[model samples]
Target chain A: MPQIFRRGRFWIQLGVVVALMAFGGLLINNITVNLIRTGLGLDFGWLWRPAGFALAETALPYAPTDSYAWALVIGWMNSLKVILVGLLLATMLGVAAGAARSSRNRLLRSLSGGYVALIRQVPLLLQLLFWYFVAFLGLPDTPVGGLIHFSNQGIRLLGLNLSVEFCSVLTGLVVFTGASIAEIVRGGINAVSLGQWEAFRSLGLLEGVGLRRIVLPQALPAILPALTSQFLNLAKNSTLAIAVGYADLYAVSDTTITQTGRAIEGFLLLLLSFLLLNLLISGGMALMNGAVLGRLQRSR
Target chain B: MNRWLDRWLTLMLLALLGWAGWSCLHWLWRGADWTVVVTNLPLYAVGSYPEAERWRPLLCIVAVVVLIVITLLGTRHGEWRRSLPLLWSAMAPLGIWLLAGGLGLSPVGTQSWGGFSLTLLLTAGSGLLALPLGIVLALGRRSDLPVLRGGSTAYIELMRAIPLIAVLFFGQLLIPLFLPPGVEINRVLRAVVAFALFAAAYIAEDVRGGLQAIPPTQREAAAVLGLSPRQSLQLVVLPQALRVALPSLTNQAVGLLQNTSLMAILGLVELLGISRSLLANPAFIGRYLEVYIWLAAVYWLACTAMALLARHLEIQLDPVRSAR
Candidate 1:
C-alpha cells in the first residue's frame, strides 16, 4: 500500500510538470506567431537608437538626441533622486508622528492618530493629484522670507528650482508613506513591554532621553523589518510619478515603448530594472539589520 | 517643564486646527462649487452606461451595499452567517453577468463599464481569482515536491518584486500577443487578470504566514481520525489557516479596491477615472479641490466599511468567542 501511495504521488507530480510545460509551450508558440505576424521580433537593438522625446525633468543632463539607453539611465537617476529624498523625509515625518501617537499629550496622540487614519484611507494617486493641481499649482507667485519662491509655475527654494511635478510627487509619496510607516512604528513601540518603560522611568531618565536610548533601541529590531518593506513600497510607489508627468524610469520607459513600438523589450528592461532596484533596497536593509543586530547583541 | 511643554503643544495644535477648520468652513460656504460632483452623480456611479441599461450596474452596486450591511448585521445569527460567504463569493459572477449581459438581456461592452461600479467589479473579480491562486501557490511552496516548491517560490518572488502598474501596463499590451491570433480579451478583463496575478503573490505570502502558524498536531490528529491527506488539508487545515489570515487578506482586499484607481491612469473610467474626465470638462475645470475631497470621502468610507466587515467576520470566526 505504501509503495502504491509513493507511485501515485510520483505520477501526480509528473502530471503537473507535463501540464505546466504544455501550457507554457502553447503561450510561447502564440507569442512567436503573433510577433511574426506583426513583424516585431524581440530584440534589444533599439537601445542604441536616439530617443526623440524630450524629458520634463532630468537629473543628469540629457537631450532628445540621447540614445534610449542613456535616456533610461537619466530617468533612473531621477527616480533615485526622488525615492531617496522621499524615503528620508517620510522617515522623519513617520517617526515624529509615530512617537507622538504614544505621547502623554492628548492633542498630540489624537492628531497623529487622525493623520494616520485619514491619510491611509485615501488613495495615493488622488493625494498626488491634490498636491499637484490644488496645492502646489495653486500657489501664488510670492517669495517666503526672500529665500523660497512659490508660484503656480514652479517652486524655487534656496536657489534650487523644483518643478511642480517633482514637488507634488515627492510630497505625495512622503505624506502617504509616512502614514504607513507611522503605523509600523507605533506597532513596534507597542510591542515593547510596559515594564521597560516603567524601568526607565524608575531610573529617573527623562521621557525623551529614555525613549531614544532605552525604548527605541529595543523596538529597532521589530521596526526595521517592517520599515524596510515600507521603504521598498515607497520605491515601488515612486513609479506613480508618471501620473503627474514626472520623468521617472517608468514614464521614460513608457515613452520609449510608445515611440519605438518595442513593448516586449521595454517591458523586459523595466522588469530587470525594478528587480535590480528591489535587490538594492533589500540588500541595504539586510546590511543595516546585521549592523543593528550586532550592536544590540554586543550591548546585551 | 513637561507640563509647560505639553500645554504649549496643545495650544499650538488647537490654534492650528481652529484656523484650518475655519478656512475649510469658509471655503465650503463661498469658494467651493460642488456642481461638478452634484451634476455628474450618475456618471460617477455608473460612467456612461447606456441610460436605459445603467440600472444593471446600479442594481449590482445596490446589491453589494445591501449584502455588506446584511453581513455586518447578521454575523451573530449562526445559520445566516454560514450563507454570507456563499453570497459574497457569488457577487463577482453575479456582477459580471448583470453588467456583461447575454442570455436574457442586451450585452454591454466592457468599454461602457466605468465609475464606482467598475471599481467594485475590478476589486471583486481580481480578489475572487487571486484567493484560490494564492492558496494554491502557498500550498505549493510548502509541498514536498521540490519542483513545485521552487516554481511557486520563484513565481511569487518575481511577481512581488515588480510594481503593479508595470504588470497592468504589460497585461494590456502583452496578453493579446500571448493569446491565439483570433482570440481576444477586453481591457477590463485584462486589467482584472493583471491585478489578480500581482495580488496573488502578496496573498500567497500572507497565507503562507498563516499556514506556518498551524501546528503539526492538527495534521497528526486528522490522520489519526482516519482522514486522507487531501481530506485532512481541505477539511482541517485550510479553513483554520484562512481564518488566521483573514485580517491580512482584508488589508489586501482594501488595497485592491484602492488600486483599481490605477486603472484610471490606464484609461479605464473607474471612480478616479470618471473624476479625472469630469475635471477636464470645460465647465468643471479647476475644481480639483472639490472633486478630490469628494473622492477621498468615498474611498475612506468604502475602505472603512471593508475594515468593519472584516472585523465582524474575524469576531465570528474567533473560536473562543464562538464557543462562548
Candidate 2:
C-alpha cells in the first residue's frame, strides 16, 4: 500500500508538470495565430525581390540589383567579416592588455586598470558610435572634397588608405570586444596559483616565460570559458553596425524590412543567420573547451 | 638584461603616452574646436526633453542610487575590496552618466543617449524584470507539476537556442500587432520586453544552477522542521543555493550591461547612438579615435564599479563561500 502511494504520488507530480507545459504551449499557439492574422502569415516570396541598395562594405560579390536573398547572404558575409576581424583584434588587444595588467611595473598596472575600467563601464554601442561619429566624422578633408577616392574605386583617407568603411567597422569591433577580452585575460592569468608564479620566477625564468608556460597553461581553463562567451558577444554585437548605417547583416535586414515591409521574413533571415553563426561559435568553443579539458586532465 | 629592457619599455610607453595626451589636448583645445564637441554632446542629452520630463531621469537616477545604497546596506563590508561587484556598481552609473550627459550638467535628452545608454537601459530593465520571472520559470521547470516543467523547459531551451537579436526583432514586429490599433508602443519598450524574456530564460538557467546546488540534506532538515515544500525550499534551500550562484549571477549582470549596447541597431538613442550622431557631424570628421577613447573610458568605469559591488555582496553573504 505504501509502495502504491509512493508510485501514485510520483505520477501525480509528473502529471502536473505536463499540464503546465501544455498551457505554455497553448499560449505560444495563440501568439502564433495572432501573428498570422496580422498579414504576417509565413511566406518566403518576399526574399526574391531586388534589394536596390549597395553595401558600402561586403566580402562577397554583390550589386544593388541582387536578389534580397543574395543581399542577405552578402550581409551575413559582412557580419562574419566583422566578427572574424573583431575576434582577432580583440584577442590581440586582450592578450596584450592582460599581460600589461599583470606587469610588476606600477605605471603599466595603473594604465591598464584605467583602460579596463573605461572600456567596461560605458556601453559598447556608445564606443562604436563615438568611434564612427566623433573620430571618423572629425577627419580633416584632404584638399578638394569630403571623401578621397583612390584608383577610381573605394573611399580613401589621406589618399593612402583603402576601404574606409571596413576599416572603421573593424576598428570599432576590435576596441569594443577587446576591453572585455582584457578582463577575461586578466582573470585567467590571476587564476594561476601564486605558488606556480613564485616557483617559475625562482627558477630564473623570465616574466614572459613564466607567463607563457607556467601561468598561461594553468590559466587556459579559466580563460577559455570567458573567451567563449566573448566570442558569442562579438557575434551578437556585430548587429550594432546597423546604427552607423554600416550595412552589416542586421543593418541590411533592417533596410530590407523598411523597403519591402517584410518584417517577418527579414527578421527570420537575421535570426537564422545569427543562430547559425552562434552555433558555429558555441560549437567551436565547446570543442576547444573539450580539448583543453582533456589536456588539463592529462596534466593532472 | 631584464632591468635594461624594463627601462627601455618604460621610456617607450611614456613617450607614447606623452604623444597621445599632447595630441588629444591639442585637438580638443586648439586643433579644431572644443566648443563644437561641448555644444553637440549637450544638445543630444537635454535638447528635446521637456523641463518637467527632465525630472523623470533625475528621479530614476536617485532611485538607482537609493537601490544601490540599500543593497549596499545588505552588505557588511566595504565594496571596493570585493573587486568585480564594486567595479560594476560604481562604474556602471558613472559610465552611464558620462555617456548619458555627465550628471545632467551637460545634459543630453533620452532621444540623444543612444548606443551604450540605450543598451544599458534595455538590458538593466530586462534583467530586473527577468529575476522574478526566472524564479517562477525555474520553479515551474522543477515543479512536481508535470505540465509546468514541460512548459518551462520548452521556453528556456528555445530561448537559449535562439539568438537575442532575433528575440528583439520579433518583439519589434509582434508587440504592435498585439496592442490595440493606433495605441503604439515605443521601440525601446518593445526592445525591453524582448530582452526581458530572453534574460528570463538565461536567469532560469542560473536559478537552476542554484537549485541544483542545494543539498538533499538541507531539504531533509527542512522537512524535519515540519515546513511545507515551498517553505522549506524558499527558507533553507534557496539561501544556500543562491549564495553559491552569486558569482555567476553577478557575471551575468555584467554581461547584460555590456550587451545593452546592442540597442543602437534599433535607433533607440542611447550612449552609442549619441556617439554615432556626433561622429557623423560634418564638422567633426576623422575623430574616430578621440570618440572611441572617451567612450571606452566611460564603459570601463561602469563595468568596474558593478563587478566590484557584486563581489563585495557575495563576500558579505558568505565568507566561507568566497571563490576569488
TM-scores of the models, in the order given: 0.98, 0.77
| lDDT of candidate 1 over B109-218, digit per residue (tens) | 99999999999999999998999999999998888776788999999999988888899999999999999999999999999999999999999999998988889888
What is the DockQ score of candidate 1, to 2 decimals? 0.59
Highest-lDDT candidate: 1
Q: What is candidate 1's CA lDDT for residue A53?
A: 85
What lDDT does each candidate get? 0.92, 0.70
DockQ of candidate 2 against the true complex: 0.32
**lDDT digits (tens) for residues A1-300 of candidate 1:** 111134467787888899999999999999999999999998999999899989988877889999999999999999999999999999999988899998888888999999999999899999999999999999999989989999998899899999999999999999999999999989989999999999998998878888889888999999999999899999999999899999999999999998888999999899999899999999999999999999999999
Off by over 4 Å in 1: A1-7, B75-79
DockQ values of all predictions: 0.59, 0.32
User: Model 2's CAPRI class?
Assistant: acceptable
lDDT of 2 by residue, B1-324 (tens): 888888888888899899999987787677554444466554434333445445445444455555566555554455633553554456445644543465555655445444333445666767778888987787768765455678789888767765566677768886675554546666766877888898888888888888887778888877788977667777887778778878878767876776665655555556555666676787775566555665566556566667877876776787566654
